[model samples]
Target chain A: MSSTPLPPAAELARANEELRHQLEEAHDLIHAIRTGAVDALAVQGTEGPRIFTLQGADQGYRTLIEQMNEGALLLSDDGTVLYCNACLAGLLQCDLSEVMGRAFADFVPPAFRDYWAGLLLKGWESKSKGELPLQTRGGALVPFSVSMNVLSFNETATLAVIVTDLSAQREITAIRAQVEEQNALLDRKNEELKREETARLAGERAAAEASRLLEGISQIAWTVDPSGANTYRNRRWYDYIGVAPGEGPSIGRAWRERLHPDDAPATLARWNESLRTGAPFEVECRIRNADGDYRWMLGRAQPSRNAQGEVLQWIGTYTDIHEHKLALERIDQGQRELLNYNEQLTRVNVDLDNFIYTASHDLKAPISNIEGLLDALLTELPAETVAREPVQPILHLMQDSVNRFKRTIELLTDVSKLQKEHGLPTEPVDLAAVVRDVRLDLEPLLQSTGAQLEVDVAAAPAVMFSEKNLRSVVFNLLSNALKYRAPGRQPQVHLRARPEGAGVVLEVQDNGLGLDAASEQKLFGMFQRFHDHVEGSGIGLYMVKKMVENAGGRISVSTNLGIGTTFSVLFNR
Target chain B: MPLQKLTCVLLVDDDQTTNYLNQLLINRLEITDKLLIALNGQEALDLVQAHCHEATPDCPALILLDVKMPVMDGFQFLEAYDKLPLPEKAAIIIVMLTTSLHPQDVDRVRRLNIGGFLNKPLTKEKLNDVLKNHFNRHLPE
Candidate 1:
C-alpha cells in the first residue's frame, strides 16, 4: 500500500473525474424512480430508513392511460417491463404485478424475440416501433406493437417504451382478405352464365328458321306425334278442308264427317295400320270439298324417324286426284260401249248367214220337185208332140235353165256355210298335199284352159288350218286361174308357200284376163265376176276368201288388166 | 230281168207336183198291182192304216218317204209306221227321199231304222238300190 505522489495538476484532474462519475450514478437512480422501473425508493436519515412509492404519483395521467382502448405498457432500456396497464395485463392474460419488473424479451414469443432486440437497439439511438407476438400466462399468443424511445429522465438516459396489443387489428385484416377472394370467384361464375345464355339463344334461332320453312310449302302438309295426335297443319290444309286453323275436327271425326261414306271405313283402317306399324301410308278416297261435292283425293303420310328408327312424327299430304279419276271412268265407259257395238255387229252377221242358209235350203226342195215333175211330164208326152222341132228346143232350154238354177242354189248353200265353219277345229295341214288334191279336182278345167301350173310348197309345208277349207281355198284359186284365161293365150298359174314372220304365206299367181284396179278392189267379194264366159256362179272366189280369213288368216289380191293376177293368203300358226 | 212285182207301193210327199211325179214314175215302173199316192206324211199314214189293217197281200210292201212337209215329215211317218198294228210291218220296205243332203239331215237319216236314203228326183238307179238293199228285189231295166 504505498502510493506514488503526483504533481498538483494530475491530482486535480483525478478529483474532477471522480466527482463526474458520482453525478451520473445519481441521475440513473432518479430515472429508475420516475419511469417506475423501481416501484419504491429507500432513503437513509439520521434516525431510520424511509420508503417512498413512485406508482400513482400522477393520478390523472394514470387514469388516462388506464381508460384508453389500446394496451399501455412501459419497458426499461434493458428490455425489462417496468410498468403495465390493466389492458396490457389483459392482452398477456396476466396480472399487472406479474408483468412489472419482468423482462419484455421474456413476454415476447420465441418467434418474435429477435425482432424485439432489434427494436430495443434502435430505441437507444432515438425512437423505434415494431410488432411482435407476446406469450401470455395461459400459453396463448397475443399480437402487440411496441414503440421505444431513448429519453433523459432526472438527468439520466432511459428507454421509454409504449406497448400496444394488436390482436383485434390483425383479425380485421384477415376478414378483408377473405372478402376480396370471394369477389374474384363471383366474377368467374358470372362469365360462365353469359356463355351458356348465348348458346341457348342460337339454338332457339335455328328452331324458328325451320318453322318458317315448313309454313311456306305448297302442299297441304301437316304433322302429328307418333300417337297420331295432330300437332301442326299448314294453311293449305285448313283451306282445303274448309276449316279454320285450330278448328279442324279430330282425325276419327273427320273420317265420318268429311270423307265420303264409301271411302271412310277403308281410309280409317289404313291410317290406323300406318300409325301402329310406323309405315308409310298411301290411299285413294273421296273427300267432301268446300262446295260439298265429293272429289277423289290421294292421301299420303310418312313417319319421321330418329337414328334408332323410332317414330318421332308423321308428315302427311292430300292431293286432288278427281280429274284423273273421272278421265279413267270415261275411258272405261267408252270401252264398254265399243264392246257392245262389236257384239251387235257379230249377231247381225250371224242372222244374215242363217237367212241365206234357210233360203238356199228351201229352194232345193222346190227345184228338185220341179225337176221330177218335168221328167214326169216328158215321160207322159206323146211321141209326135215330143219329137216336134220347136218343142225339142223349148225342152232343152228348160232343162238348161233348171240345171243353172240348181248350181246357183248349191253355191248359195256353200256361201252360207262359211260363217258356221269359222270356229271349226284346225290341225296341221300339209300345204303340198292339199294343193295336189285341189289340182286333181281341177284337172279337167286345167286341160280345157291349157293352163300351166307350177307348185312350190317345200319352203313352208304345213299350216294350222282346217283340211277341207284349205283344199277348197286351193281348188277355187286353181279353177279361177283356168276359168279366166286370156283370149288366144295359155293360162299360166303358180302356187307358192313360204314362211313370213310368225306365219305362212300361200300365194296363187295367174297369167290370165286380169282385172282393172276398180274390179280388183272387189275381186274376192260375193257375186263379183270380171269374166262372164266362164261357168261360174260368181261365188267361188268369195268362198275361197272367206275360208282363208276365217282361221286367223288374211287374203290379198293383186292384179293388172291383161297382165296377171295374184292371190296371197297369210295363215298365222 | 224284171223284178218280182210288189203287192202295193206308197208315195209320200208334200208338193202336189212331186206327188204326181212320183205316182207317174211308180205307174210307169208297173212294179206293183196297187199304187198309193199321198200329198203328205199324214195322208200316207192314213192310207197305210186303212189298207193294211192286217197281214194281207193288199198291205203296202214298199213306201217312199219325203221330208219337209207341213203336218208330218218322212221321219214322223216312219215313227207312226213303226207303231202300226199291221202284222206285215216288219216285212215292208221303207226309204227316205229328200232334196237336202245337209249333214244334220244325213246324220239323222243314218241313225233311223229305215231301209235306205235317196236323193230326189228319185231316179231308177236310186230306187233299184233301195229295192235291192231292203226288199231283196230289183227294179225293171
Candidate 2:
C-alpha cells in the first residue's frame, strides 16, 4: 500500500485504490463482529461470554436477555450448553459456570429427557416449541414452556431457545374446573328444595279440604272411641245439638239426659249391645231439640276398623225424622176418625130403616081397616036410605075423604119403600118406555088438562137406573106438569133424552105455570110447593132429586114465571 | 044375603068392639047358626077345644084368626090347632083376617094352610065368599 498522488482522474483513481484497501479491512472486522464467529473475544470484567458484540447495541441486547422473566439459552448442534442468561441459570437453580458446557438433557427431568432429545433431533433446520419439566441439581422439579430455534454460521449449527415457567397457567385452569363443578351441585340442590316445597303445600291443601268437607255435610256427624267416649264432633253436630264448641267428652254422656223418657231405656240397651259386639249401631229415638221439645231422630253409627279388625272408632250421624213421624201419626188419627164416622152412619141407617118399617105397618093397617069399615057401612045401609039426596051426597063426601086419606097413605108408603130399596141393583132401563107408562097412568089427568106430550128419546133411549125409581120419577113429573097447567094456554110437555159426554141427559120441559125465584129456591125441598092452588104433597120433586142423586146422577130445574119450566137430569152411563 | 050351611062361626080378636061387630055381622048374614067369641088366640083355642070335646053335632064349623094379638098370636094358634086330632079339625074352615095389607103378612098367611085371607072389618060379601068357596054353599036371599 503507498501514499502517492496521481493525475486528477488517474491520480484520484490510484489514491481511491489505496483508500479502498483500508475500507476493505474495516468491513471485514465489522462483518466478523456481527456474525459472532469470533472466538476467545471477551468483554472484560463482565458476565458476557466469548461472543462478538454490536458495540453498544450488543450491550443493550445482553441486558435485555439477562433481565427478561423468561429464561434464555444458546446451544451447540449437539445440544450442549454454549451460553445461558442469568434467568436461565436461575430457572435451573444453578450457577452460570455449572450450566456452561452441560448437555441440555441434564437440566431436563428424566420424564422429559426423550422430549428434549426429540427437539435436538430436528437439528438447526426448524424451531421446536413444547411444555417440559426441568429438574434442578437439588432433585426438585420445575415446569417450563420452551421454544428452540437452529441457526447455521459458516456451515456450523447452533440453537437459540426461550424457556418459560408454566406453574401459574396450570393453577388458573384447575380453578376454573372446580368453579364449574360447584355450580352444577348448586343446581341439583335447588331442584330438590323446590320439589320439597311443592309436596308440603299439597299436604296442607289436603288437610284444608278435609276440614271444609266436614263442615259442609248436612247431618250431625260425630266420632267416638271404642269405649263410647267422644273424640271429635263436626260443626253441624255442635249447631244441631245446641252445644258450645270445645265441649269435653262428657257431652256425649249428657246426650242421654236429652233423650225421650219413653225411649231412653231401650235405646241405652241397644247401644250397650252394639258396643259389646262392635256391630253397626242404629236406633230411631226421640231427641230433645234446642227448644227442649222431643223430636224423632234416626241415628246410625258404623265402626271404623283397623287392619287387625279391631274397632278404632265409631262414626255416626243423626237425621231428623220429626216431620215424617208426625205425618204418620196424623194419618193414624184420620183413619180412626173415619172409622168412627162410618160406624155412626151405619147405626143411623139401621135406625131409620126400622122407623120406616114400623111406621108404614102401623099407619097402613088403620087405613085399610077404615076402608073396610066404609065398604061395610055402604053395603049395610038400606037401598032407599042410600039413594036419598042429602044422605047420598053426605056419603059421597065421606067416601071422597076416605079416598084422599088412602092416597096420602099410599104416597107415604112409596117414600118408605124408596128409602128401603135405596141399594137396589140397577139395570139398563128404557127411559122412553118409562115415560109412556107414566103418561098412560096419568091419562085421565092429561085429558082433563088437555096436555100434549112430546117425547124425543131417539138420541139416547136407554139409561142405567132402577126401573121402579125411573117409573116413579117419570110419573111424578108428568102428573105435576099436568096439574100446574096455566089457565089459558094448553099444557105442553116435552121429554127428551140425549147423549152428553159420557152420560145421558133426560130433560122434561113444560109450558105450564112456571116458578118464581123464591119458589125455585125452595124447589127440591120436601113439603115445598110453588103453587098453593095445586094439590101437591111437595114430596114428588124431593123424591125425584133423592133418587137421581142416590144413583150418582144430577138434576137441575130452570123455570121462568108464566113462561115454561124445564127439568134436566144427567144420568151417568 | 045369608050363609045357610055353616052351623057355627068363631071370632078371635083382642079388641072387644071388633069381636062384637063381627058377631053382629055374622048374625045379620045368617052365615052361622051359632057364634063363638074369644079375646085372643089362647082364648079361642080353649073355646074350640071345649066345643070339639063336647062332641056337639055341629062342632065350630069355621074359625077366624087374627094376627098380632097380646098373648098368643095367630101363627101360634095355628101351630096349636095342628096338634088337635084330625077328627076335631075335620069339616072345619079356618080363615085369616088382618088389618095389615103388608106383603110380609100376606106371604106369611099364604104359607099357612088356611081357607082364605081377608081384610079386617070383614063384611058380609067376604063372609059369603068364604062360605061359598070353602063350604060349597050359596047365600040365601
Q: Candidate 1 on A1-573: residue-level lDDT in tens?
A: 239666588776898788888777567657765775544423223466443334334756656776776676555555566556777777788887777667767877787778778888888888999887888898888778878777554443557667776767788788878887888778877777776576446534433443466578776666777898776677776677677765644662243367889899989999999999988999999978667888888889888765567776787877788999999999999999999999998898888888888888888878887777777778779978888999988888889999999988888887887777888899999998898888888888788777889999999957999998888888888787777878888788999999999899999898888899998878878888767777677888888778877898899989989988898999988
Model 1 stretches with alpha carbons more than 4 Å out? A1-237, A248-253, A259-284, A298-319, A432-458, A488-494, B1-12, B31-63, B71-89
Q: How many backbone clashes does candidate 1 have?
A: 1
List, residue by residue over A315-398, the lDDT tens digit for candidate 2.
Answer: 777788889989989999999999999999988876776676567656665665566566678878999999999999988998
Q: lDDT of model 2 at residue A251? A: 52
Question: Which of the CAPRI classes, incorrect, acceptable, medium or high, describes model 1?
Answer: acceptable
Top model number, TM-score: 1
Q: How much lDDT does candidate 1 score? A: 0.78
User: Each candidate's root-mean-square deviation in Å?
Assistant: 16.4, 21.1
TM-score, each model?
0.61, 0.55
- The two-chain DockQ for each candidate, comma-separated, is 0.40, 0.16
Model 2 alpha-carbon miss at residue A222, Å: 7.7
